[model samples]
Target: MLLKPITPCLWYDGQAKEAADYYVSIFPNSKITSVQKFNDSHKAVTDQDTGSVLTVAFELNGQPFVGLNGGPHFKFNEAVSFTIQCKDQAEIDYYWDKLGEGGDESKQRCGWLSDRFGVSWQVVPAALVELMVSSDPEKAKKTTAAMLQMKKFDIAALKAAGDS
Candidate 1:
């Protein structure tokens, strides 16, 4: 299949297909669209096996992305992350747990975590944003402080802070 014109490409050493599969399994409205494999004709260019996955095009919650098995020359870092806006605490907990599975716990904080594939993700609650940007400065400040101390966001906590 042809690549999407403006899809975000995720670089992985050799886990493109695995990541794509995992992502599609967890996210609603997500699926693997296509997989391109490396061939012998391109053996000299990449370290992957001739028939191994070269790239996988997938969508998570309708957002398109491409996972590339582009060797270890590059790595994922905290600079880029996908933000999943969840409706409530249950949704936040689900994504936080799923994305943080086998991930670096020490590096996770404030609604951000790195997945097992080294991809950073932000599992944020939709209500938190409004609270954090509320017209009342005290509410916003309280929400911000509450958020800073959390790994997985608690919508109840956030609402309480805003109320306080």
Candidate 2:
């Protein structure tokens, strides 16, 4: 398939294929688009084995992304993150648990967590955004406050807080 106009590229030390497969497994509407291996001509520049994975193109929930085995010079940080907007509690739970597995719980806060590869992700309820932008400023404030204190968002709790 042709690439998207703009695709987010994830740099990995050497787990590009592994990360792509794991992400594909987690999201129901996702798949690996393509995989490229380092060739003899490129091996000298990349310092990778000729047959090692060079890049992996994948889709997560329909969003296209590329994962590159670009060595350890760069690392993922909180500055870049993917947010999954969930319609309900079940969706939120599924994402939070799956993405948070093998991650540092302490580093997680306010619906944000890092995967095993240290890629930051936010599993949030769709309602939270609506609540935060509601016409009632008080409701928005309450919901925002409630969300600020959560590691994994509880949609019911946020709604209750907004109502109160």
Candidate 3:
């Protein structure tokens, strides 16, 4: 029977296990669940190693995610980012603080920050999204306009812009 839903799979260039361990260590309620190694039954031409891990499955912040030690055929980019809807600035700050380590920061409007991992994160407050896209179209437009110019989310600035 299915118990927990499957999580996202992340590909790292032969660093899948290391990355999974790092992520689990940073997030509470996290652990490595299973691991599989490479064997001669594999299909890759270069991956003939006797005992290389093919995949590392783990949980971070109670969410399951798998990491593959795939060869350096691909890399992560800013095209896709994990969005964290925060109830308050404290929660946003907490995640920002943790993930921003060893990463660059690009503060974006309305609570968005790009962590050092070159991963863009929308650290948006739930209320802020609602307010920015409220029933008032003009207000929302104004708020969006102000947001377009910012890197770090500024609720007060957006509100003021919306009002005017």
**Model 1 bad stretches (over 4 Å):** none
Q: Write the per-residue lDDT of candidate 1 for residues 1-164, one digit (tens) a residue.
A: 66567889999999999999999999999999999899998877766678899999999888899999988899999999989889887899899999899998987999999999999999998766687998889889988999899988888888898898
Model 3 residue runs over 4 Å out of place are: 1-6, 40-44, 104-118
> What tens-digit string does per-residue lDDT give for candidate 3 at 27-142?
77999999988887785555548588888988876677787877888876666777766677677667766766766554444456655434566666667777678788998999
lDDT of each: 0.89, 0.92, 0.71
Error of 1 at 123 (Å): 0.6
Q: How many clashes show up per model?
A: 0, 0, 10
TM-score of 3: 0.75
| Model 1: pairs clashing at backbone N, Cα or C within 3 Å | none
Error of 3 at 126 (Å): 2.0
lDDT of 3 at 147: 79
* Ranking of all candidate structures by their lDDT, best first: 2, 1, 3
Score every model by TM-score.
0.94, 0.94, 0.75
Clashing pairs in 3: 103-116, 104-116, 107-151, 107-152, 108-151, 108-152, 109-151, 109-153, 110-153, 111-153
Per-residue lDDT for 21-134 in model 2, tens only? 999999989999999999999955878998899999999989999999999999998999999989899999999999899987877999999999999999988876687777
